[model samples]
Target: MKRVIQFATGNVGKHALPLIIERPGLELVGLHAHGPDKVGRDAADICGRSEPTGVIATKDIDALVALGADCVVYTSQAEMRPQQAIEEICRFLRAGTNVVGTSMVWLVAPQHADAWIREPLAAACAEGGTSLYINGVDPGYSGDSLVYTALTLAGRATGITVSEICDYGSYDDAEFTGVSFGFGTTPDHTPIMFAPGVLSSLWGGQVRSLADVLGVTLDEVRESHESWVTPEPIDCTMMSVAPGHVAAVRFAVEGIRDGQPVITMEHVNRLTPITAPDWPYPPDGRLGVHRVVVHGNPGVEINTRLGLDGVDHNDGGVISTAARAVNAIDAVCAAPSGLLSVKDLPAAHADRVMW
Candidate 1:
């Protein structure tokens, strides 16, 4: 069994560690937090202690490293800059400890993460002979891995696009609400994601990844975003949302490497109590529509939804996605050294390992 050490004590880690402990080839070791106050507390305390583990949380990176853990799963909510995430990943890779973590958004996306973060991480992993993986749902699963999965249905395809649409009405966390759905702000206040350089930063790597699989070179990439606010105010635990519920955010990336454009677009909407009006709730809550449209000689259109019938995926989505953040620990250790993506590793189902 792989000895696994957790570097976070929050909800993200809390949700994952329990399941990881039960996996046949894995053993839960200890928990570490960047916070001084959390040090010395039982790992179960951090997770509400519905069950108990003797492990205590600590802030000592070196001490944790000395544990000779086969893998480290970082779930901390630390606000370290992008470079810090790279540094931490490097530390584990150098220690011969494979790493899996949820630190940043779209770490593998060619358009969003800085080269400084990427290049060093790759170098460190290669030098240490360890694998490092970064993953989550949206940019991680939806943006890249799912794109790769969708292409499986195609033969001699020209282009493809995928989108997510849903109502985030029940989500009440102010911090998350503000950033994700763009509450208390106008569309202009949010970053213009589709601009030339901007487009490449978001999901351009997905286009690049697909191109690599298809043996094509992308000549250019472009992207854009759109959001709407409800006309009146409604109350949730987080904030009193005005304008009703926000409209959808439509973000698309167009890859033009082969004289024609291959586009991928995402539509995210918080359309529950009041959505676009025509959209219906998908049993789970509101709705999330992932649509893929391919245009060419034998064109095709496909759409799917993720959450199960009774599962409220809004909150569960973040936690479930975060759980998968640690799902690649074994693969990260066994694979050749370097930065790895979810699709890069051998197949593993996160649901089977949950606490």
Candidate 2:
């Protein structure tokens, strides 16, 4: 069995650990958290389980390394700060431990500036004879699997378009409901690009990656946002955000070559229900849906409601998305060194991440 150490005790890692530990060929040996009094806590309890294990969470890196696990699972927030995240990843690789996590945010850091991140990370893996990969549900799905699936339906396609529509108003997280979707806001409070930019950071490369696969030269990538605010309040219990929502978010991206559009992506998030009359097709009548359309001769479109009820934006959607990031540990470990994007790695289908 592959013995593993989870490097953080956050909700993501906690949710993924039980699944990992239950895998037939895997053993979850340790739970490491940076919280105070880190050691001797039950991993299951930390994840909100009633049953507790003797396994304690810890902040001692030396202890973790000495635990002699075959690999280390990192779900740390290093991704928020690109530079430091890369540095820490290098340390894990140099320590002769296989590493995996969400810190692969540097996947597309400009090749010219901070290009050193690539070479050194690659070298570290070689030096320690280790491997790493990083991916999340957004980049992993819309960027990798969904687009890849879309390409399979096309014949000599010249362009591809993928979109994810999420009604954030139905979301519960304060960061997402209030700050992300701009629930109660004036024109000056938040720009349209706020939530859309996050999507760009995660999936823009997917567009570029598809372009690379099709040998198309991309000239420009542009994004636009749309919003709606409820005139009055309504009562709802689906998400933790405010009741009777105030705002919603939707975004679109266009990829062009020589001023000609070739690829596109759109994401929509709203607290209240929505219908897109402008879309060439009918809206899925669900709170959220991931839609991928490949533009070539006889274009093909694929749509799936990935939320709570195939149309509802429930905690299940957020939890599942976050779980995808941690459950992808082994795939990331198998990927080639250096920062990796969803397109950089293979489908995360391993006994290790199956929860």
Candidate 3:
């Protein structure tokens, strides 16, 4: 069994806690809670597990690393604190611990990572002989590898687009919704998330990854976004929105090749499905919808929906991200040292589950 340490028991990390506990081949060695409120609590209580996992949450990173885990499932919001996250990851690798997570979307393509990051990350791996992987659902698997999966079935593909339409009405992170998304802010001051090059920074890796997988060199990645204000004061799951405040936003990051838009990654986020009536909605008129469209000789479209009768995915996006990280532990632990992406490892099959 591979000994594992779960880092950051936040929105995403909390979902991973139970999955790690459920996996028979993985042993939960340590838990790193993000805040003091969570520290010192039983892992089971933090994740709502009935039975005790016997692991207590700790805020001490050094102490957790000293556990000597085979792999660390990192789920911290690296985009918010990139430098700190990178330093911590290096410490883990240099201590001979592998890592897998969706923290830094840019690192999905290590070759495309910035020089400052690539150099030190390489050094850390060399020192401890460990590997690092960045994986997730949207920026991780859906927009890149999943897109590639559809592209392989196409005959003479011309262009590809991946669109994720999800209602954020129930997302519990107020800071992520109201503050970062500008849900209650005026359009005169657009959200920082839609600022110059921010969209590309968050998702350009997926576009670039697809370009590389297709053997096509991209000229650049372009960004465009639109935000709609609420007609009246409305209350959603995360927070309340005032009249004329931002409620819905549609954005895209397009990959340019040979002076043409070759690959596009788009997101349609809204406080509610009805907020953006003019914009794209769920294909089946549900809560969660992800579409992978390939423009080619015959054309291909793949739609994945959540919040159904039997399976409730309206609030499962974070869990999906966590699941991807947890499932990759073995592949990441066995791989060679240094920065690694999905291309570097073998197919990470789900243990005892269907392919």
Candidate 4:
């Protein structure tokens, strides 16, 4: 069994902690709780399990590293604390601990990373003989891997578009909804997500990865976005939106090669489906869906939806994001020591994973 340690108890962590306990081939060794309330609590308790898993949560990073697990599922909040997260990931790698990450997704293709991330991650892996792989749902499988698989039938591609159509009313993130997304703010209020080079930093790596899969080198990667006004007050699951404020938005990051955009990643996000009447909606007129359009011979277009039995689309996304990393634990632990890309690993699925 692969020994596992989970850092932090957030949305993904809450799902991962208990999941690691139940998966047959994985052993839960420790939980690195981030908040004081979670520290000193039983791992199972932190994730709402009635019985104990014999693992306690601690805020002490060094102590957890000393336990020396086979892998660390690093899912801490990354958008705000990128440097700290990278440092923590390196520390774990240098201690001979492999890492499967849902945080700082740009690492999905370390080649797209700047020297600050790529250099240190490489050094740490070499120093301690470990590996690190980062992935998730939208930026993970749905971004590049799924596209690569779908392109199997293509002869030559003209253009490709991956669209994420999701309603954010049920996504419980106030910081993202209110400020980062400008959900309850005026048009002039630039959401950090829309700031210069922000969206590119987040998904450009995936764009480049897809380009590489298609055997093309990009001329440049560029971004474009537009936000709509609410025109009236509305309340979403996360926060309240005021009239005349930014309500919905559509954005794309394009990877250009040979003076044209060969690959594009787009997102259509609104507080609710009806909020942005002109923007694209899911194929089924639902809240959340991932759609891919491959513009080539024997063209392919498909929509994939993932949701929990009783949970909303947002919660299901969190669970899926966690699953992508957790299920890859054994593969990452078993790979050669280094910063691994999706290109370097085997098909990342667990046996009987659907069960």
The numbered model that scores best in TM-score is 4
Model 3, runs deviating above 4 Å: 307-312, 353-355
> Which 10 residues in a row give candidate 4 its minimum summed lDDT?
346-355
In candidate 3, which residue pairs clash?
307-313
Misplaced by over 4 Å in model 4 are 352-355
Predicted candidate 1 versus true structure: per-residue lDDT over 269-348, tens digit per residue: 55355645644334344355555655554665555555566776565665666667666766677777777766677765
Candidates' lDDT values, in order?
Answer: 0.64, 0.61, 0.83, 0.84
Ten-residue stretch with the least lDDT total in model 1: 278-287
| Residues 95-191 of candidate 4: C-alpha lDDT, one tens digit per residue | 9999998888778778888788789889999999999999888787778667877788678779999988988888888764457777777788788
Candidate 3, TM-score vs. the true structure?
A: 0.95
- RMSD, one per candidate, in order: 3.7, 4.1, 1.7, 1.5
Off by over 4 Å in 2: 36-40, 103-120, 176-181, 191-200, 234-246, 274-284, 307-314, 322-338, 341-348, 352-355
Per-residue accuracy of model 3 over 184-291 as CA lDDT, tens digit each? 788888777877988888788778877888898888899999899898887877788888888888889999988889899998888876687898887655777878
A best-first ranking of the candidates according to their TM-score comes to 4, 3, 1, 2
Better of 1 and 3 by TM-score: 3
Residue 178 C-alpha lDDT in model 2: 58
Q: How high is each candidate's TM-score?
A: 0.83, 0.79, 0.95, 0.96
Model 2 is weakest, by summed lDDT over 10 consecutive residues, at 105-114
lDDT, residue 40, model 1:
85
Q: lDDT at 57 for candidate 2?
A: 82
Clash list (residue pairs), candidate 4: none
